[model samples]
Target: MTNRHQKYEVLDGLRGIAAISVMVMHFLQDLSVPVLQSAYLSVDIFFILSGFILTHSYGDKLHHALGIGQYLKMRLVRLYPMICIGLVIGAISLCAMKLDGAAAFSVGNFVSAVGENFLLLPYLGDMSVGSFIRTSAHGVPTLGNAGNFPLNPPEWSLFFEMFASLLFVAAIRFDRRSLLKAAYASLALFVVYGMMIGINEGKLTIIVNQGWRADNFVGGFFRVTYGFLIGVAIRKMLDSDGAPHAYWMSGRLIRSARALFVAFLLITLFPTSIKGLYPLAILVFVAPMLIFQGAKLRPGGALSARACSFVGWLSYPLYCVHYPVGRLVFTYLPNSEQHIVGAAALACGLSIAAAAVLAKCVEEPVRRYLMKRFAGAASRSAAPPVRAA
Candidate 1:
């Protein structure tokens, strides 16, 4: 097993910031600022991070028996606890939203949704089964994810993460050549998909993010394919695509400081460009740059390092709990900007507290169990001891 010390401190901090960006973006977009409009790009950052971490950890070991199984277990242990909690919270909040008249309730779908919301596979069934975001002509709410009432909207990204991770395991078990081919093919598909979104919007664009629809969900697929493969490609290129080469990037054109700046800017600043092309710039350049630089980060001072670690530790559960926390609060509080500042602050605090609870009570324990029982077994199986003659 790789040492925990080897984990990238800067990337963890970036993820914490990104997770906060996502939550804040969701919270404030309706309240009028919308400065975090670009925060959705954080999804791409996550995809890149996933690919980088997965390849670094398992690229060479995937050919061994149990490697894939254990990898899946580790990922599931990390994901499922928070997912179940989010879904439960979402389901209960669905009733609350209905009472608040944010949505019209259906008993059958609610029961089914309570049962099926945890399905990790987006392709098997419609992800819109329980969505309740209102459809309106205005851009504000219209741009929202319109499925799965009170269910964590961001869970859709995790669905893509699961699918992409499965594909990554498959590629790793195959030869490097096959993985390269798959990456190229997926990239081609993403380009075609991006072009379609751009043409429809009259510029380079791709907007199907964290949404579930018959047609729009395809956008998420293309987005994931591009982001995840770029991650794999970057790691592979840094390693000279499996050939012998020095891993340090030449001349260090980009540094971890630049990475921190760019990632923060993407999440927090307004993109002063043709809006349609923003996602293109992020997916094509910025996200990958952040990952590359993040990989190269040297540990900073103790205070900064601890802050980064705390943010990283807070990120996952923060992400998992934010949407449901927002829903519950807004159900009782007004959804409009009537008390925008106070509303956002309250949602942020509640979400962070909920995340801390979940991380402490759920993810940590589940991960410890999986690590104790399966991590070693999986690692051992991947490089089984040779029997003596």
Candidate 2:
């Protein structure tokens, strides 16, 4: 067991911000704001975060006796609670939509959409499932096109996360160095491919509806693999103790701070031009400090820590529930930009509250039990233990 404390607070804050961005992206029309339209970056941020965490947790024990089944079970328990809640809510709203003649009530459409989510196929470039914003098979009245009553609008991303994790596990089993090299090579290939297809020039819409969109999903894969490898590489570098000055030295802090600030500025200012550089910049600066600093806190840090932790804990569940909740809230409210904006904000807030409650009351206990009873201890028999500092 490593005696280092994981920076749970920092991770929590990042997750919270990411989830909020997704919510805002969905409600872009309601907010009547054009500048914040690229909230989809939140999804990318999440992929990076996932990569970071998994690498931190499992990288040192890459050859440990962890089994595929345990990994999959943990993911299932982590995912199922929120998804089940969202499904029930979606089904009810869909029924109402059918009753009101808002949707055609095609059984095929409904089943297909539901099954796609349940099977986690949407993340793989599957378009059979409708976006949460559009009216689905139930024809239920939605909050414009933004609240499509899909069981969970954000679920497509979850599938990708799961797939990436499994692939990473396989990579770890063979050779970590090879995995890193392959990830970098794949990313280079994607950027070249994207430019060839004019994705960098903003013709993504044209390629998305056609047969060649497999590359569209490649971006997502790159995002996850890149971030994960960065974290693992950083860990390995630090573990070798090759740096001249200690990581906590004042000089290192100052240099790292400058690097992080520059990276953030570049990404926020010119997102499209320097899309690939920002993560590397962050890795250069932030990752080292994070590994060394662990979870050190200042006097007022506890309050912020709790708030961020709450948000992070609720983020996944809130994401699962937001689409249906937004749809229901909008049914009674008007549909103008401002009205829908307010409704969406309210929906986001309420969903967060709902998720927090569910996390505390249901998710934690159920997850613990499932992991103990059904996840199979033999699967993770040689897994490393993570200990607090």
Q: Note the residue pairs that clash in candidate 2.
A: 67-379, 102-139, 103-139, 132-148, 133-145, 133-146
Q: What are the models' TM-scores?
A: 0.81, 0.71
> Please, what is the whole-model Cα lDDT of each candidate in the order they appear?
0.63, 0.51
Candidate 1 achieves a global lDDT of 0.63
Tens-digit lDDT track for model 1 on 96-160? 66555555536765666556567754432322321122221112322232354236667778887
lDDT of 2 at 87: 70
Top TM-score prediction, candidate number: 1
| Alpha-carbon deviation at 160 in model 2, angstroms | 0.6
Model 1, runs deviating above 4 Å: 1-5, 121-145, 148-150, 173-181, 194-212, 241-259, 266-268, 271-275, 334-336, 370-376, 379-389
In Å, residue 243's CA in model 1 sits off its true spot by 12
Residue 223, candidate 2: alpha-carbon lDDT:
54
Q: Which ten residues in a row have the lowest lDDT in candidate 2?
A: 204-213
